[model samples]
Target: MTAISLPSAMEFIWLEADLLDSHDYAAWLALWTATGHYIIPTERDAEDYAAVLNVVYDDQEMREARVKRLQSGLSMSASPAARTVRTVSRFRAMDGAAGVFVVRCAQHIVEYKYDRTRMLAADVLFWLVPAASGISLQRKVVTLINGDDALHGIGYLL
Candidate 1:
């Protein structure tokens, strides 16, 4: 198998961000490994997300269900999903296990809805595993800058 490079990892991350900004859930979902986890912790310093109260902690099945709901236009909060533009940058990579690596980046997202605009920033970590296709996301943890504060009106993916 060919080794993945830092530039390639950055490219893949950018693609994922673009897919999210465009609301292309299907394409975005395909970027994950079968056992991939998508986690958003309410506590900025939480180590084990399963033991803590998280804004989101989804596995493959939950992710699929969420995508279905977001695309179905049935849920009130998601029916008119907030438009978002995300910028992911300041990428730093570190090797994890034998074939896995972690990419850490800063993400700033601007969400617009109901004539109001909100800005959310986070430090995101993506654990990536090598795959035949190059790389796939094994885990994603988003630690919001103000995660301990009350947060609402988020109706779409982060």
Candidate 2:
């Protein structure tokens, strides 16, 4: 099998991060495959995918519903939305089976509201499949350093 180029993988990471940081939720959601899974793990061992809470696990239709809710102006929790900035670094490619290319990285996400600022550090595993348009996400597993702590949930994508 031909190896996926580093530049190609990095480019995908850059584009994905840009879409997420810019809060282009619809465009971002469109990039996932039909069976894609979004998981945020409570522990560091995200490779043990069995131990995680899935924040977004949707087919195309369910993903569309989520986007619709965000756009309807009915999500009151997002009225005074928090500002978010996510920085992803230290990307490394990994070999895997199942026609998926895996990229591991570290992420620092900072979110700020009027009176509160929350910082999150996580190890991110991005499982991607090459698609006609670009890379389609198969799974995005984020293992937060402090996943079990009490924190307010941001209404939008993280």
lDDT of candidates 1 onward, in order: 0.90, 0.75
For model 1 the TM-score comes to: 0.96
Worst 10 residues of 2 by lDDT: 48-57
lDDT of 2 by residue, 1-158 (tens): 34456677788877888887777877888789988877765555445555455544455677678777766788886655677788988999887777789999998988888788888888888888888876788888776777766556666665
Q: In model 1, what are the clashing residue pairs, if there are any?
A: none
TM-score of 2: 0.83
Instruction: List the candidates' TM-scores in order.
Output: 0.96, 0.83
Candidate 1 per-residue C-alpha lDDT over 1-158 given as tens digits, one digit per residue, 9 for 90 to 100 = 57777888899899999999899999999999999999999888777889999988999999999999888978889888998999999999976777787899999999999999999999999888778888899999989998889888688999
Model 2, runs deviating above 4 Å = 1-3, 43-61
